[model samples]
Target: MAAPTPIDQITDKVERLLLRHEELQRTNALLVEQVHALQAERDSLKSRLMAARARIDALLERLPGASADERKERT
Candidate 1:
């Protein structure tokens, strides 16, 4: 059997690199999708937190002797 020539070695390496490049591209796309999903989740959580804070503020306002200045000092 004939041994592989230099050209054959180079071609084989190039093919392997191309395959690796394709695999990396697929992995990068999946990571991007995950980042987008996480960003949306983070935004939703921030909105929920803001709503909860508003409700707490409202409840505090209804409490007796809970003056605006007192609230500011507590914070």
Candidate 2:
């Protein structure tokens, strides 16, 4: 069998590089989508946390004999 010419070798290398570039582009797109989903999830969790904190504060305010000084001292 004849060995590959330099041009043939370079062509093969170029093809491989193009395939790698395409694969990396696909992977990057998926990563970006995942990051956006995670960001939305984080925002939802933060809002939920804030709502829960508000409810706790309201409950604490309603507690019998729970003075403002005691709440400040506990924290």
> Model 1, range 1-75, lDDT digits (tens) per residue?
899999999999999999999999999999999999999999999999999999988888888987899987775
Score every model by TM-score.
0.94, 0.93
lDDT tens per residue, model 2, 1-75 = 999999999999999999999999999999999999999999999999999988888888888998998876764
Question: Under the 3 Å rule for N, CA and C atoms, how many clashes does model 2 have?
Answer: 0
**Which pairs, if any, clash in model 2?**
none
Q: What are the per-model C-alpha RMSD values against the true structure? A: 0.8, 1.0
Question: Each candidate: how many clashes?
Answer: 0, 0
